[model samples]
Target chain A: MRTTIMPSVRILIFFTILTGILYPVGITFVALGIFPYQANGSMVERNGRVVGSELIGQGFTGDRYFHPRPSAIAYDPVPSGGSNWGPTDARMADSVAARRDAFIRKNGVPGDVVVPKEMLFASGSGVDPHISPDAALLQMERVAAARGFDTQKSDALKELVMRCIEPPQYALFGEPRINVLSLNLALDALEKGYPPPF
Target chain B: MITVSELIQLMLYALALFLLTPPLGKLMAMVFRGERTFLTPALGWLERVAYRVSGIDPDKAMDWKGYLWSLLSFNAFGFAVVFLLQFFQSSLPFNPQQLPDVSWHLAFNTAVSFMTNTNWQSYAGEVTLSYLVQMLGLTVQNFVSAATGIAVLLALVRGIAGRSTGSIGNFWADLTRSIVYLLLPLSIILSLFLVSEGVVQTFSGSRTVTTLEGVQQTIPLGPAASQVAIKQLGTNGGGFFNMNSAYPHENPTPFSNFLQMLSILLIPSALVYMFGAMVNARRHAWVVWGVMFFLFAAGVTLSLWSEYTVNAVTGVGGGMEGKETRFGVANSILWSVATTAASNGSVNSMHDSFSPLSGTVAMMNIMLGEIIFGGVGAGLYGMMIFIILTVFIAGLMVGRTPEYLGKKIESFEVRMAAIAMLLPSAGILLFTALASVADAGLAGLNNQGPHGFSEILYAFASTAGNNGSAFAGLTANTPFYNTLLGINMLIGRFGVIVPMLAIAGSLAQKKITPLSSGTFPTDTFLFGVLLTGTMLIVGALTFIPAQVLGPVAEHFLMLNGKVF
Candidate 1:
């Protein structure tokens, strides 16, 4: 017992410093050296001001911009989480219905046109950056109209959405989706006749 | 109902795992044997330094008692450091978020959870833990606890491979080798890859950013990539942030998600092959791998079907709630099955909002004691217990003694195996019942009726099985849950480990018998089927009643358009 205790404490302390301090700190340095843009939270700058991270979603309520998925935590990056509403929970059904109604009304889509499920359901992480391409397309009419785009400009806007659509990584993983922040940023760029964000 | 693309992706993932297994497994076997490998040139010096600094004689072996004692004492000391660190977190350095000291019960729960390799987080990470606690306390435990598991397994392997020997292996040497040779190098590479894909690795505090629409959002940043790598690789699923892998910065892209999912099963799956190499039973290892793969595939298929099908009550076409759009149904369901099966409970999607039947498959994976490619070394040992039971039953049918790898499976080995098998089951069921009747448990539920019951059952099953994935809806940070779940995590971990070491000790002292026609062949295809059957029967018979009251009952209620 005595033999075990001394070695145990010594070994624990040794590992604690090695793994706890040196490993993570070492990784941080290497990552910063190689991938500074990504390692430092992938923040996007607009006109030299930090606007938001490209990977993190922020709530966009205006008709001029494409909204991200409904956030359970209202797109708060800190203290992030989902609604965690069980499928059979009435509250889930109620919220989905409410979100669906809002989506149809806000976008001025035909009542009969199916709303994308991504638009109705809150994401697991409140700050999920991407939305399905279908979900983004449904909002194009409202976004283009708010920017006062004609039919030709709407077609160009649609093309921009197509360009913004990121296929699953290597075209084999995850869903084909669009980054809402980047798309909305691109929308601003296109309207102002500036270069595309991506 | 599965699409062609989803099918192709699943197959690709499986092929990747199958291809990576042999090399990783061989590397591990060499490391544990203290043989020279490619890594020895770079890492051999570190191992020697660890031994010298700790005053450990790496060549000196210990009996099973000494090995177990050393492991427990080290873990107990770890538990103390983690617990105390949480209490003094406000005073500790690197608390950029300025989070307060954790409450005592929650601290106890977090300590027990991480120390046991369960990583069942009751408190949110970004909001609760400081960088110092996250790094020194939790991340440190992630490496050591996983190393401890692999070390115990190495001891057991030595015991099995030994001939008329009392000494198993040196615990310190095994533990150090696991970190130095296997976990550290793998983690560094994975962490760097994840950083390249946008998983955060920084010392800076949360950045308050202005949105395009002029809203302020606080983006939490940390040395997340480093921890995320090990949390997946080690099967210690505690997340750096509250949303775990679901948060975009933590997982970033679909490619990152695929790799993280792969990392969850990487070590556990390879450890099966390592077991084979060490015991000189390569064919038997493949058979074990086959059974684990079969169980895992079945769970994934069922979860996909349930998730893809329209919800009967809500009439939703796809079960998209609480899932990220980028992952969609297939990736989310695959991750769900993989995480639970491997006992790597870090989630890219919320399990609570899954369709009732989909939720059941995830719950069932843990209830099976996480041996369907379970936690790093813990999974192989847990499956070995089942293997022992299968051989014993086969021996009984043929009216001869059971022999596994030339060692006779006598009464002592059988008894220890039974204790190992039964303890986790008892911990899960008993704790669920206790929590169910208590008002404190009832108060924590996010959903009512049977679904609420599922929340309580899932919590206990997760803790007692030492698989930390939560149903998430259960408000489990309260005193009642923290204390109960903490106790159960200890029981789930050591209960199996203690008995497993006993069996290893007993096996080491026993003389090997020559193979005869009467001996049940464990490496045969027939034995794989029998082993799979025994595992299912034991798991089903033990937990089916509780499962019925929870997910099963909820399934029927869901079909009937019942909402709670």
Candidate 2:
């Protein structure tokens, strides 16, 4: 307990302080300092009011808002679930087929409609916040018609969807996915009288 | 044993990677140590804070064994901590989103996954982990886990280079400094850079924004930058977004792509030089760097050549499926090389979509033990096994006592090294064979017959090697995959590590020997080539027949434009 380099008592205290206390404290402080907003779960704001975090996806079934990938959690942060059900799992296949069928029926589209696969299968985490542009496009006409906008206006909205499409990092890794949540935010601002396209 | 078609595709990718690692590795070491940065002053602030927190005193030297032990223990503690978090997530604080309690099997998988730095992620990233859990649990572990890897490598270098010295660097100091000086600042800046490139950096929840069609849209958000930084820095592949860094906001621009690529290989590449520096032999580092370069370049060229070659049959745009048009073949090949070489399994491009041959090369990186610039600490240590083998083999050929630097190679050292090297190869084979026979396992196969067999082989290889990249097509995370992979990751890493520690302890007690006429030359160009050959031969010999049975048959089937 009395060694010169690091006493046993000191060793216990030092390690406890270092790993249990300091390591967590250090990262937390840094996270708070640098990405305060993100450190808070990327909650979106509207007119000084708080909203959800940007990291978790939400459900929007009625062509009212762009939908995210299917999730068992549906944006719950704890107990984050995955549709880890295998491709052949009748339950998984059924859920996906149901989603596919519902998606088609709601939009009055055929089975072969090019809805992105990401939108049908439950994401690894049931809480994916983005959808494919193709999936978003699936609902464009429906949403536009419901909004009493010109049928032709769907094309421009699809372009806006493309505009918000996040390219691959380094343009090399991963399938291209549009953050349905972010694009919808831009759309909301547009609906409420925001100016030219971003 | 992998078919020529598969090997050829892999060779193209490897060739490019071989050219890429040295510069990237060198630059990363430099960057983490405070060399080149777009914003220098701010990075300095980050470093200072890290210093204060880790309580690093520059003057003290750490005993080699203590350092290695601390490195492993820290990770072991992390697993415990993450497990506890999941075990008690429903009762924990700041879990505002109110996620569910984690299941035991999946939680166990998560614990081993992150602690091992494989981050295989049986559960999805966002839903399973809370803001508190993500920031404090996974993200923190990412930094420390990476630091642990770097520190161990530093200790090994000391073991090799120590003439009569009894100690290596302090584990606490290295871990602290690594996270503070290397990982922290780099991640912060890289995070900001990613944000600037349009990656989201806020904690905003689902936003109800209206689209042109008047329908409301929701935007999801959380702490991305911190995780993004470590994901690449640590070479750990679990993503904040399920799509991982491939999500547009996570990696938005071409420039960000370059940054991510740079981040993935940064610490690993630099640690090679550090190896050289610690051993007092810059030439030794160069030799390792060169072999890594040769192998990496071959992978790149093979990948691109196969990608560009179009399908040997069918000829339908080379089936270059799952590739981002924006980045092209070059980025995919480079990413594959960097990720596989370093044990970072995060993928932007799906290996599943690659030609049968291209996928084989990528898989080979894991089977070869990823010493083609391997992971931060793990890669270097794995390479040291080969280094020991090279010395011993050469010594036997010449009837001389094997020596590295001043350390005499002995029976204990060689035996331990053999264990360290043999475990991963054994892991891939034993597990793959078990999987091939298991009906539950065979049910996970997506592609049929040989190619399907390759999928199972690849899963175990990647898991057992402590390399987490997947073939991506197989349905992992069932009780079968979850349990099997969890066991593999645990045994693969510690299986080798326990042996590694034994070797270290044994070597630490040995008296240093002076170089003599009969001593094997390890620093020359010829030896470097020999070491590389030894590594590849050992890898191919172990995995080739299985590969031939798997992807090889699939390749011919594809070339003949038919499924097996």
Candidate 3:
């Protein structure tokens, strides 16, 4: 029993240190040298102030900005998660109805105008930073109206949204998407200088 | 229901997987047998060092009882260590976030989840656990637990091919070789590649940053690339962050996404060929691989169709809700089916928002024992159980004594095989029943109606099957789910393993008989179909009623244009 049990305990401890401490730390050390910006969290910086991570979603509720997907966690990065509501659930249907109604009223689009499903549905992570290109385009009217932009400004805004559209990853895998933060930042940059103040 | 593009993507994914299986499988066989190969000179020193350090005698073999005890004790130690780490994380080094201790039930759940290689997470990763717990507790279990599965598998394969012997090989030796030669080297290479592709690998704490809308947000950071590499390679599936592979840091580029998806099945797929090599029957391995591929292809076809069809309630096609656009619909559906089929439950899309029929397809994959290139060593063993049952049934029909690989299928072996097969079934059905009736279980539900029922069923199925993906609608942090699911994880993993080991013990003692006209050749296509059929019939018959109540009913409701 001693022979069987003692070696097991010692091996467990040895492997734990090897895998738990040395391996991850060693990898982190190498990553720090080569991919520091990403290894640290992909934090985007502007005007010497740290902005959001390129990978994570942030809350952007103002009508002047193109909204990302509905986040069940309200874009809380710490406790990121989806709504977890099933499609047939009454709560999900009601929430979708409410979001659609609000979106229709806010955007001032016709009642029959087809809304992008991503607008009404919550992302699984609750921190999805991208929305479908169509989802972003659908919100263009509301964002333009809120910014009090004229025809030329609205068209420029449209052009910016088009430019912001990221092609499907590798032109093979994902859907074409527009990063919400990037688009909103571009919106701000269009108005002012490169730093784009709040 | 599937579109042309979706079909193309599914076909391409399947083609790539099948094309790579044979060589990888043969390489794994060589690795297991201690044969000299290309990686031997480089990795052989690491294996010898591991043996020397652990004081494990690689030449000494153990009977089935010794192997089972060592496996159980080793896992028990892991569970204890993980549980203790969760309790003491605040004091642990590298905890830059200053995260506190975890609750008892949740800690128990997390420990068992990782130890069983299920990797189910009831709590969000970023807020609950510090970096120390993630590495020392969870990541360690990811390696050992996966190695444990492979070790058990090698034992079984040896038993099948043993010549009048009771010894099934040294548990410590197999476990060590599995980690040193197979898991460790692969993880190191994959982790480096993932880091190159922008998956995070750092000790830095969460960074506070301003959003474009002027809101201050904290973006969580950790040694994600390392963990993600092993999680997929080992089929562990626990996410470093709450979002799993969907979180771009965990899976940043399309190339990385493809790599991660490929890694999930790489070992499990190779193990089939390894089984053939160990048994000296390479043709039989191809037969089993064919069966698994066919089942996988069928599941993906159903899922693609279900996902592509326009929603009845929303009147929208391309089921984009709860899916990351970066992984689009086609890739997401492929991943959904592949993850479940492999019992590697890391997901790029939320299964909860998948159309009802599609969600059912994912559930069916797990419920069918996840043997379509299932988890590393666990999948082939699970498939072997069904193969045993298939041969036994065929023997009964022919009025002849049943034999597999020259070993007779006696009452004891059949009894053990039956127990091995039925244990997970019991875990799924019994727990689902308990949770359905209990107020505590009802409280965890996020949706109402049949979809809600499916959420509970899916949780139990995922745990009991040792596949960790969840429907995402159930709040499973409470003690009821935490403890119950923990029990399920244990029963699901070991219940099958122990009985399978006992069968190996019995089989190892049998003398080989010469093949005659009566001998049933398992290497044939007909036998492969029989094996697959037996698996599906057993699964479908056991779980169909529950399925009808959940996803099936929901599917019908959608067709009626009625949201729950």
Cand. 2 TM to true fold: 0.74
Clashing pairs in 3: A84-B473
Candidate 3 reaches a DockQ of 0.59
Model 1 earns a TM-score of: 0.99
Error of 1 at A174 (Å): 1.4
Better of 2 and 3 by lDDT: 3
Best by lDDT: 1
Q: Candidate 1 at A74: error in angstroms?
A: 0.5
* Interface CA root-mean-square deviation for model 2: 8.4
- Per-model fnat list: 0.90, 0.03, 0.65
Lowest lDDT sum, 10 consecutive residues, model 1 chain A, at A167-176
Q: TM per model?
A: 0.99, 0.74, 0.96
- Candidate 1, residues B1-564: lDDT per residue as tens digits? 567777888998899999999999999999899999999999899999999999999999788998899999999999999999999999989998899999999999999999999999798999999999999999999999999989878878887889989889999999999999999999999999999999999999999988999999999999999999999999999999998999998998888998999999999999999999999989999999999999999998888877877776767756678889878888899999999998789999999999878888998899888999999989888888999999999999998888998999989989998888788888888888888889998899999888898899899989988889999999999999999999999999999999999988888888777778777788889999999999989988988888788778887877777887
Model 3 CA lDDT for position A91: 66
Off by over 4 Å in 3: A108-112, A141-156, A193-198, B1-5
Q: Show where candidate 1 strays beyond 4 Å.
A: none
The 10-residue segment with the lowest total lDDT in model 2 chain B: B312-321
Candidate order (DockQ): 1, 3, 2
